[model samples]
Target: MPMNDADAHVAAQIRAVLAAAEAGGGVAPIVEAGDPILRQTTRPFDGQVDDAELAQLAEVMRATMLAAPGVGLAGPQVGIGLSMFVAEDPGSLDPETAEVRQRSPMPLRVVLNAEYTPATSENVAFFEGCLSIPGYQAVVARPRSIELTGVDLNGTPIAEVVAGWSARIVAHETDHLDGIMYLDKAEMRSLSTNTSVAKFWNQPSTQQAASELGFTLPSSMLL
Candidate 1:
């Protein structure tokens, strides 16, 4: 599908942001995964949104997701350790080609330091990946619908209901900024699809990281 003017504009902005990050001038700075900041639940910024910084973040997220080959990306995943994520609306798939194509339905929404409340008790499971953990994926259970409240990239407050895959995307990315991984909420070994988890664990450092993180490998993660 042809992109509209607004969509095209956002795409262009995303590209520019990513380019700057690649040049080492866009993102604020990198933080280690186990840093204290990553563990705390992210709080909404009280002051006005800095358009320049927010724009850079959105661009970095977009670029990071594209580079990592994932549908969504959060700020912490890129090492910025902030309450932000840039996600393509999971429901906006383009059915024209063999490869899946999706766009942000709300024109690149930037949920800043958001909080999520499930609107429905109905739960669903989906395959999820992370930009922080490259070359791995898992089947994680998530709420089918949610009521999320947060400020946008421009710092405008929003409290809206979302359903389908969009809710999942938002919830998954939000957790990243809070330093929570999907494995933290996963129910069983089958939810994990990390094919290389065993191999990676065979190495001493990787094994140590897994052990330190308290991640157990699932024998079989899929049906």
Candidate 2:
């Protein structure tokens, strides 16, 4: 299918970004939070680029996410206003921490035009940091499980219920597609610098941080 004018423009921009990234050692510079691109809703994928180009784009996104050492990366974070993201977690946390967060290994996956909704009323709070924000972490309550729907790079449909840390990952990435940031729903009082988070708020759960920082957790999480 031929791209419309808007899609063609976006495709050209994407190609330019990819070319620049390749020229600059294969990793695109992550756009910061203040960029307008990060604030606008992303455009959905439609044959803007061919399958081979899309695959290359996904690979570059994967490499960028890994290099950022972040579990997720959305197109807007790299200055492309596309509804796509890459996510993966090595599940490297210690057993106790992993159990507390319900975190496990998540293989690298690319999701395009993704959206999600709560699959259960249960909510969980944990500190999250974004690469675009770079140096701050805050506690955000999110659905413990979610039904995510989207397509893969090959345009295969994806519909699944994901829980625990995986759910959080999907929720965060999907929000980018709609121009929402985690901080928008976060407990501002629970915000802390990366150093502060490491020195004071490092724990399996947010209970200690919430109590000490004068913030409150969801009723379900309160002991």
Candidate 3:
């Protein structure tokens, strides 16, 4: 889809800020939950955010995500209410041993005005975390596979079928664009502090959360 003109002046201001961040400036502050910005539905990037400006935003966001050491970040998290988000999961690691588990790797990528369709009836649940909602995780369930559609910074289209952790990351970030957070889909009783997660629910699968944590995990997620 094509973009229209938004507040042109707002666009210019953001362009300059993003450019500065791209040039080794400070990372944009992440907005936390209960902030009105995170609750507001983001608008599609109008012509106001030109391709060059969009590219700069992507770079800065990527840098911030890597610096935060998170697998995903969204525009709203950075106080930009635009329909854009970034996600990358190179692999998983053992925090104690620093041993990397070769999970499916997703290189850094940005998607704008993203939309997705569930490609499978099966559901997958995992203990997911977020940058905005730091130091905690919850069991969130979603389609095991999905067809994601969106655009890059250059106004081109992007479409792909993704599965595993990649699908979870895509679903989580796109939810931010829609003013939705992972907590919305998370099993409330399964929520845990980071330390609690490490202690009680840090098993190979969330199937243990039900028995050890005394929470209900959907049967579909048990493999």
Candidate 2 local lDDT, 87-164, one digit each (tens): 999984589889989999999889999999999999999999998899999999999999999999888999999999
Which candidate has the top score in TM-score?
2
Which pairs in model 2 have colliding backbones?
Answer: none
- Model 1 regions lying over 4 Å from their true place: 1-37, 89-107, 191-223
Query: Model 2, residue 105: displacement in angstroms?
Result: 0.7
Displacement of the residue 68 alpha carbon in candidate 3, Å: 0.9
Lowest lDDT 10-residue stretch of candidate 3: 94-103
Q: Where is model 3 more than 4 Å wrong at Cα? A: 1-6, 9-13, 16-24, 93-102
**What C-alpha lDDT do the candidate models reach, one value each?**
0.59, 0.89, 0.78
Residue range with the least summed lDDT across 10 consecutive positions in model 2: 1-10
Q: What is the lDDT of candidate 1?
A: 0.59
How well does candidate 3 score on lDDT at residue 151? 88
The candidate that wins on lDDT is 2
